[model samples]
Target: MPSLATRHEGHVLVIEMQRPLLKNALSRALQHELVSAWQELEGNDDLWIAVLHGVGGVFSVGHDVPELARGEGDEADPEPVTGLFPLELSRPVIAAVEGPCYGLGFELALACDLRIAAEGARFGFPDQHLFTSHKVASVLLPHMASLGIGLDLLFTGKTLDARRAEEVRLVNKIVPEGQALAEGVAAARDMAQRFGSAEAFQKQAIWGFPGLPLSTALNLARRM
Candidate 1:
């Protein structure tokens, strides 16, 4: 079966990561599949938004270290793990996370415009090791939560449970365990019905964040 799967519910496209037995690890093949899915979400005008989750009650444990080491099938080239999606997708995504969201999994969640994490879910940055890079997390975490928390999590490889994640605004909200998908899809469907391309337009302004000058950011929002 494909590592990643996609389906549509009205204008909301749902992307599911399959690999429960392996804790939905992000192997090289799976990473490519995610990029493809994001591209589809971007190019398909009918797809307004996306909800990303994993099977078997877990978002993702992390990257498949062994696969990353040996490389996958032949030529053996590994790209820097730049999170799961493009730098900026025109369409927004929602991460419905449960269980352990670590390493690449945490990056995937952070990449989403909003995140819905199930109760008991765990979040962690990858250990500070030669094989892993947390560039995406390093950039986003400080802004998402706090600079001190980001430094602590990244440097110490500490993990946070869903309550703490929500408190820090790492996750948009926390739902009952096993309800992340249902809640996330329902929320997406509601937003899809109420909003249109305006969501993506607003995202451009939000993504600019602390970098873009206030006047410039205002112009972008106004233009959108």
Candidate 2:
């Protein structure tokens, strides 16, 4: 079976991570598949929203540590595999997480525009212990969660469960185990149909013009 699977369910494009044996870790093959899948979805007009999740019990337990440990794949910059999705995609992504989202795995969820987790889902960042730093988490965590919480997660290497994540507003919602993908896809479909392309366009405009001042941003918003 393909390590990653993509299918269109009406306006929603569901991307499922299918490496159940390894806790859905990001293998080299899976990484390439995700980039290709997302690129195809971005080019297709039939799809408006993408919902990302994993098969088996976990969303992702992060990188394939054994693979990395064995030096089995091409290595370049230490940036996480999630960086494969360039910031220019011009599409909104929602992540449905279960089990453990650790290291780069949690960063992938953070990269999404919205994240929904199953009850008891776990999140953590342990780059320091790995003798490397998480560039994405270091740069983007403060923007998503409180500075204190972000620091604690990044620096202390503690895991946060769904309830703690919800209390901190890190996850949009939490559902029963095995229901995160369904709930997340439902939310994505609703947002896509109800808001249409205007919301997507607006998000692109804002990210595309981040250097603009407040007055300039307002002017751009008016034009949109």
Candidate 3:
């Protein structure tokens, strides 16, 4: 079976990680499949939003440990632009996290526009135990929360439960266990119907303005 599967509900595309036995560990093939799915979502005019989740009650445990053990690594240098380092898709994407979201998985969720985490969900960078650096999370987490909190997670390699994740504003919403996917899809549908094209521009501004100087950001906002 494919490592990733995708289906569409009206304008909301649902992308699921299919490697349940591995707790949805992201192998190189799965990463490529995710990128392809995002590319398809971006190219389809009918699809205005997306929900990314994992099957079998797990979002993802992170990169494939076996692959890393074999020295295959996550992916080659200069990773694909689509899913690596948060590509600028015209439409927004939401992450529905159920179980453990660690390492690369945490980075993936952080790349999404919003996150809906289940009660049983946990977030962390366990790979830090191996002294490995997470390229995306290192940069994204601080922006999502305070620098102190982000560094705490990174340096300690500890986890945050669903409530803590929400407290820190890492997740937009929290639902009962097994309801994250449904809630995420419903939220995506609501946004698709209400946001229209303006949401894309708004998202662009949200992502772009953070890195700009105050005067430049204000000028850009004025133009928007």
RMSD of each: 2.3, 2.4, 2.2
Candidate number with greatest TM-score? 3
Number of the candidate with higher lDDT, 2 or 3: 3
- The CA lDDT at 113 in model 3 is 89
TM-score attained by model 2? 0.89
Best by lDDT: 3
Residue-pair clashes per prediction, in order, are 0, 0, 0
Model 1: CA > 4 A from native? 72-83, 126-130, 198-201
Query: C-alpha displacement of 137 in model 3, angstroms?
Result: 1.2
lDDT of 2 by residue, 1-224 (tens): 68999988888889999999899988777887888878877888877888999999798877777777776437433455554553556778889998898887787888777889998799987545575566777766776677899899977889999999988888989999989999988998898888676245455776655456889888888898
lDDT of 3 by residue, 43-123 (tens): 888888889999999999887767666744345422423454343877788999999998888889998989999999999
lDDT by residue for model 1 (1-224), tens: 79889998889899999998888988777888898898888888888888999998889977776676787553143443444654587777899998999887888788788999999899996455735667788888988899998988888888999999999989998899999999999999988877766354456556776667789878877877
Answer with 1 or 3, whichever has the higher TM-score.
3
Ranking by lDDT: 3, 1, 2
TM-score of 1: 0.90
lDDT for model 1, on a 0 to 1 scale? 0.82
